[model samples]
Target: MTVRTTARWALLGALALVVTACGGTSGSGGAAAASERQVQVSATFAQGGGGPAYTYDTALVPAGATVEVTSAAADGGTTTTLRVSGLQPNRTYGAHAHTKPCTPAAGADAGPHYQFRPDPVSPSVDPAFANPQNEIWLDVTTDASGAGEATSTVPWTFPPDRRAASVVLHEKATATHAGHAGTAGARPACVTVGF
Candidate 1:
């Protein structure tokens, strides 16, 4: 073969190798692994005697992904963010993820504190003695206009058999760091994260 022809063939072979390594130009034909999605949550609060009652627009979690709760409450309510990761799809995850449920009504119940009882145990025991790592807490604080932000990083996996589930924000305060229930209160607002 002529020198020019040989050079042309070599160039074509090199181009083919590059395309194969990069998964070709058609993006859809590449790997089927799940991609990460951005989820955002914003909230507002109603004025209370000492502070403000927490109210959230909604909570979001994408299917088959983990969300990093980056910023829940910040700057004394001027900014708040929460991050959550490793979430399960299509399941109804309680917002508090506490040992007990939060009070359903505003101003009347403190609801359940953020506690996860050890398996096969009693409520009388101190929450600290139980699984403290299981507790998920949200920062509660709002500006004069009752606006705030909450974020969580959640790693979630989608179930191929069913539609993905959602993350919900409650109206009440989650248990404080001290494990006090019935004070977290009620569900003022909520949001569902998807896709």
Candidate 2:
């Protein structure tokens, strides 16, 4: 064969080797491994139309405060974890998945908590429907340095019609009282998350 033919053969051989080195795109009949979906949102507390919106006190959700929500589903169950940073130190804050996106106007714009079962009310006050088992309650108490994490694993996934849209940070831990069950005082900041 000519030198040109030999070079063409060599190039073809190298291509084959490269293809072998990299795993083929097609699967091997078995179900492909599931991939974890992570949604990251940065929180901000700024003065609203009235005044400082995020916090009732002088404390502010420090700059660079962020919320990270990660979800993985397998074996007929799903686990969701949320981590937050740069909040008020040594304070517990009520957090929940909301149904609306975070806008600059006010925390109210973020809408209500993303309840798995439709509460049939704007703000769910009943403990039966507003408990952590039914809602995403990621209430966290910051350390001295202002960081915390919470996790919730459920047998079901989020609502298909309306997924979690944002995470709202409240000023207090959620309550369990009747007709006041999911009350977390004063939403100071909201982080827009996509799931």
Candidate 3:
């Protein structure tokens, strides 16, 4: 081949390699894997505050405590992680994604859990919709240093328009029983996360 023809072939080969490394543009699921969707938020808890984070009961979730949340979606699934510091030591706390943002007025303002399938009944005590597989449950246990982390992965992703708005930290671990499913103790702290 002539010099120009050989260079053209080399350039084409280079372009092909670039496309392959970038997962190609064929609208295939491979590209989706390469482009995992993720959202992260970090905030410090405060008492009587107006912010992305609030602590209704400063004893469990003390003022100045920090929380970092990460939500990632890929392969028809979603994983949520919660990390907290400066909380009460040697304690287990329950956390779940909520449908509304955290408000300073009340921890309950965060709304209900972000269920994969909505429950017809109010306060959804049914185990069908309140289970960890259907909801994001991140129960964390703090160490002596008052730091903890918990991660939860579900088999499905959130609908684009119906995503969770916040994560509420409860006073105790989640309960798993009919008539009391998904019930944790009082929500002491809440962190607003866009996921």
TM-score of each: 0.40, 0.72, 0.84
Model 1 CA lDDT for position 37:
30
lDDT per residue, candidate 2, 1-195, as tens digits? 699999999999999887766545433222445333444544444444322224323365654465566666555555667677777788898888788877766777889888777788767999888988888888888888888888877666754566877777888999989889999988877766775
Error of 2 at 169 (Å): 0.5
Alpha-carbon RMSD of each model: 12.7, 5.6, 3.7
Per-residue lDDT of model 1, residues 1-195, tens digit only: 699999999999999899876765455443222232333432222222211122222242222222222222222221114443322223223243332222223321332332332334333134453222333445434333333434433323222332222233444444434344323334442322231
Error of 3 at 11 (Å): 11
Q: How close is candidate 3 to the true structure, as a TM-score?
A: 0.84
Best by lDDT: 3
Against the true structure, whose TM-score is highest?
A: 3
Task: Compute the lDDT of residue 69 as modeled in candidate 1.
Answer: 26
Evaluate all candidate structures by whole-model CA lDDT and list the values in order: 0.34, 0.71, 0.92
Instruction: Report the alpha-carbon TM-score of model 2 versus the true structure.
Output: 0.72
Q: Tens digits of per-residue lDDT for model 3 on 1-195?
A: 699999999999999899886665565675776557899999999977667999999989989999999999987999999999999999999999999999998889999999989998989989999999999999999999999999999999988789899999999999999999999989999999999
